[model samples]
Target: MAISKSQQFFESLWYRKTVWWLWVFWPFHLLLKLIVWLRRSFYRIGIFKSTKLKTPVIVIGNISVGGTGKTPLAIYLIELLTSQGYKPGLISRGYGGHSEHYPLSLTQSTSASESGDEPFLIYRRTKTPVVVDPVRARGAKELEAMGCDIIICDDGLQHYALQRDIEIVVVDGNRQLGNGWLMPFGPLREPKSRLKQADHIIVNGQDMVLEPDPIQAINHHQDAIKEPITAVAAIGNPERFFKTLDGLGYQFKRQSFPDHYQFLKQDFESFSGSILMTEKDAVKCLSFADERFYFLPVSAKLSKPFLQSLMEQIKAITHES
Candidate 1:
């Protein structure tokens, strides 16, 4: 399929230098920035009220428009909280989904088309209570009513309506705050200075080191064919995933689709070799996927000090409440 014009524009903003169109869009970018600033100011000044739930809320998101490993970090937090005997629930804005209802609860059986790919994937992997709504604050309320003590919001850094106790920003190590300009002219949704306000700024794919032989890590039982595979990704930053795979010493052809491109069985009919994909894409392919299809799972590897600091913050919040 041909890339959309919007995609082309975003690419120019992120990867290219000194494009004439950027100057043309500069006025619009400033307007958007001013509007965002005013909206945030309203929330800060109580003109636009923010809902604070009794249950503590932790938001995991990125300032940029594209994916920055937020889902994996949310999953990691869920697992961490679970191990500590805390009941954690998740809430998402269901970016690519449309539901007849306002707040939809997700389960392993929930369709990705209805609950959004990330929310359904989280529900499947963690089996934790997951709720999706355009109004994230309402989603948090639903999760709380379901008996959750802590809520992990998948992506709501700019959703000021939901008052979050802790804000965790996930950044792409390779792309770092591209161009450092907000919106149309660049990739940032908020200014780089916003990073200072975040409780934690986690960089994804930073520690990926080249491995000598990644085939040794694959489970032979799942795949008898030891032939080279094709690495496929339908994500915001495909290059990051591709480079990470290369670091893992995987020999594969690269195939990238537009972010969140819905995959059909026919999409894979042309390729015959084994296929590897990201966990996000794998959630959509489960029905059609065979033994040859494998997804590489990743987790946020925060530093020991960072983890300790987070724990202390959570403890303090709980004590005050």
Candidate 2:
């Protein structure tokens, strides 16, 4: 699908330094801020009650519009918790999916169209139970009923309706906070001050000094095709993926699509040679994909100090409850 001109214009303004036309959206930004503040205040004062489940809930989310590795971070947490002997279940809002039912449980047979792409990817990659619902609290309840000991919310930092035990805010190291302005004027979903409230703040891809890693081995699948490949991403920030590929010394054309973009077979018909995409996008393409398509999965390699802090907090929360 073609991107709208208005969307392109605003994205440019959001990432670039302050431009004169940015003021045109200032009123809308202020309105958004008011709504956000009031909504948060209501939750805090009990006007809007937040449901707290018996099991501890850990949220991996961001304050910005685009991706900050929430899915990767969530997967990381799931693996970490499981290694620590916790049965962690995943929950998501299913952003780009529509279903006849609520709290749809995901399994290997579940299609990406039924569950959102990210949730499907998580289920496929981790083999963990995933539940999708617009009402995340309902999803969490389902997970708890399924014998999960802990819950890891994919992207719900601003979702005050479900009370969380640990809040993790993931930020893009390169794009930091994008003009530092809230929605309409910039990319932020919440004020920068909100970072202080999060139990942990993680920066994705902080170590640019790329060393030999497992990701490089995955790219070797393209060797079968002699022609140059194209790296296509239907994610929020495609540049980060491209930069990682560049750091790995791979050469390919870049094709970017809007976040959560639904893929059709025809989208790749014109392009030849191998195609690379993120795991999030790969889930949707598998039905129509072939040997020419390969996806590079990323993991959030968080610092040891951050991991220690997170483990400490989880211990305290679990002990207290």
Candidate 3:
């Protein structure tokens, strides 16, 4: 799942302190800013209109490029809503998936290759209705048709085309806003100021905690994989996953890959011992995984105060509807 050397170099340049080389991408950064501003203006003045769904839509995403624990938060929200007699549905852009169709309603037989990793993993974990489509408004509509009382968008904070009732922006506690620059220059997809407009800002380590569950086997029994393991992650922040494993006192070789990487059987052909990965990566490897493949699952432990505030907002929205 490792990315190319050039990709590695660019990531390092973006997050780390490298001053002189940043000039190379300065022009592109300005252009991206201009485009972002124009898009927002269009949506603001009615030149472009956002599609508002009948059911309330809550978008959970990050302003930064890499993972800020959006999937875990989305899952937590789904569970929270379901416990209160609300039928919640999830919609995602399906970043790595190339489905033959749009607005795909996930079935139990759906594979990660078709519905994307996060959507498939969420559906498997929650047994809730999940839809994948590039146009999130259409996906939201499909969820509404499926009898969902509310919709949870996995990562579409800047997707202005889909009107959202509440926006929850998640930020990595350690990496706050890398270099505070946009796109090629830094990790931000939007400016840091955009966070001011969000309904709530959830910092990964502060507002919510990611508690790792018992590691489970992907293809066999829980005790199948032996010691001398190798943990791999194809997530936005592989180091974070490795750090968590270390904190849990598990010793293993570390392997990192580009985000949303399509894993193959040949990738693990060299490893002699057990292979461990994040639950997101586990979904993609399930098709070709062996007994040696295992995955670590993490659950979001949100603060009670935030939970109370969130439910209050949802109740207000429902009462209005």
Candidate No. with top lDDT: 3
Tens digit of lDDT per residue, candidate 2, span 203-252?
Answer: 87662111223432122343344348799888878788898888867899
What lDDT, from 0 to 1, does candidate 3 have?
0.89
Where is model 2 poorest over a 10-residue stretch in terms of lDDT?
208-217
Per-prediction TM-score:
0.89, 0.93, 0.96
Q: Between 1 and 3, whose TM-score is larger?
A: 3
Over 4 Å off, model 3: 1-5
Write down the worst ten-residue block by lDDT for model 1.
Answer: 208-217
Point out the higher-scoring one by lDDT: 2 or 3. 3
Ranking by lDDT: 3, 2, 1
By TM-score, the better pick of 2 and 3 is: 3
Clashing pairs in 1: none
RMSD to the true structure for each prediction, in A, is 3.4, 2.8, 1.7
Candidate 1 per-residue lDDT over residues 11-130, each given as its tens digit: 656755647767776887788788888999999999998999999999988888777778877877898889878899999998667789979998655788788778888888799999
lDDT of 1: 0.80
Q: Candidate 3: RMSD over Cα atoms?
A: 1.7
The per-model lDDT (C-alpha) reads: 0.80, 0.82, 0.89
